[model samples]
Target: MNTKQKVKYKKNSKKKMNWITDHLFLFPTILFFLIFILYPILYNIMLSFKKMDVSNFMTGGVWAGLANYQAIFSDPLLYKALLNSFIFTFACIVIEFIIGFALALLFRQKFPGVNFMRGLILVVWMLPSVVVGVLYKWIMAGDSGVLNFVLTQVGLIEENILWVSSEQFALIAVTAANIWHGIPFYMIILLGGLSTLPRDLYEAAKIDGANGWKSFLKITLPLMKPTVLVLLMLGLINSFKVFDLIYVMTGGGPLDATTVIPYYAYKLSFLQFNFGEGGAVSGIMLILVIILAIVYLKLMQKEEAN
Candidate 1:
């Protein structure tokens, strides 16, 4: 070959090699994403359109063509589950944010044992969801529960309250436990955000006669908006997908009072052996989470632009 042609051939070969090497490095991650995430999502979507029970799950199930969606949409239990999920998510996020913000503020002050206490607060968050659920279950139990004993001794209650087993209180019980487990997470995130604030702003505010509350409203919140938005989105997603804790605590029991979407999907899939309906529930949840994620991304982009 001519010299120029040979040089061009060498450059093309080098480009090809570089491309191959780059892709080779990415192959493992791509493979895992496809296998563990994408494949299951696509499979579940397919299953949601089919009529599948335990017997037909192994084979390709018969296509029912939106029957699963229709069934779930028409079911009153589905509505109940949706409502419960909304309530649980709302309560968890609001309460956790408030308590966490307060705790973050408290820990922001320099004091003796503050670091130790901050580390200790993470114990609740570090515990496994199932462990937290089981622990709370015992603590909230009716007959010999610590909560009941304490409340009664303090003259707050005349009788032992069935926290987990009572239909009226089962959702609240699960929510309370979830709130306790989730508070540390919020505290950590908010505290990190709070630490990044400019100390000079507070000093300036003080000099300008802006009181604590006024400074917090005008400076702290506005500066922390992005962090707060991110935390709210994350907390919403996490709260919506709560299953292990609720299952361990109440099993969505006491007449389905705490039957949030995840647990409902679990009950349909495993307990009732109805994979199609369960898949439909999961697909709906997936869509909701995706929408929330998109909103979060958009908000983050807007924040970055600002």
Candidate 2:
């Protein structure tokens, strides 16, 4: 070969090797995504179209087309689960956001042991959901629970309210537990957003005679829009997937009052041995999450563009 041709060949070989190496670095992540995420999702989609019960689980299921989906839609339980999931998520988001924002504001001020107090609050969020569920289960016990004791002492209730056992209060009990566990997370996110605000804007607002509330309404809300949007989107998705706490605490009981979508799916698959129906419920949740995720991405892109 000519010298220039040989040099070109060497350069091409070098580029090829570099390309292979760079692509090789991504192989593990790609493999993990395919095996753990994509494969299960595809398999579940397939399973949702089958007629699978405990009787035929070992032998595999017959092709049922859209039967599973049809059954799920026809059942009133599905609608009830959806309603409970929405109510639980909505309550958590509202209560957690309001309290989280307030705490974020308070912690923003310079104070004694501020960092320690912040860290202490985070301990609640850091606990595993199962642990939090267990803790609340004990606290909400009707007989000798601390909560009932306190309420009785304070005259808030004439008797134990049966927080987790009664159909009337079971959903509220779980929701309150979830809210407590989630508050620190929202507080941290809002705190970080608050930290990024320009101090000069508040000072500028002061010159215009803007009070604390007025300055917050004018300056803080507008600037924090993106952060708030992202936080709420994430909170919604996470709340929808809440099964561990419900399982550990209520087990979707009190006549299914706390049976949100995730736990409902679990009941169909594990308890009833109706795998096809369970997969259909899961598919519904997957669609909801995918829609939320798409919205989140679109909002992020818009924020970046602006």
Q: List the residue pairs that clash in candidate 2.
A: none
Estimate candidate 1's alpha-carbon lDDT, on a 0 to 1 scale.
0.96
What candidate 2 gets wrong by more than 4 Å, as runs, is 301-306
Compared with the true structure, what per-residue lDDT tens digits does model 2 show for residues 1-306? 999999999999999999999989999999999999999999999999999998898888989999999999999999999999999999999999999999999999999999999999999999999999999999999898899999999999998889999999999999999999999999999999999999999999999899999989999998999999989998998888999999998999889999999999999999999999999999999999999899889988998899
Clashing residue pair totals per candidate (backbone < 3 A) = 0, 0
Error of 1 at 83 (Å): 0.5
TM-score of each: 0.94, 0.96
lDDT of each: 0.96, 0.95
Error of 2 at 294 (Å): 2.9
* The candidate that achieves the highest lDDT relative to the unseen native structure: 1
lDDT of 1 by residue, 1-306 (tens): 999999999999999999999999999999999999999999999999999997987887899999999999999999999999999999999999999999999999999999999999998899999999999999999999999999999999999999999999999999999999999999999999999999999999999999999999999999999999999998999999999999999999999999999999999999999999999999999999999999999999999999
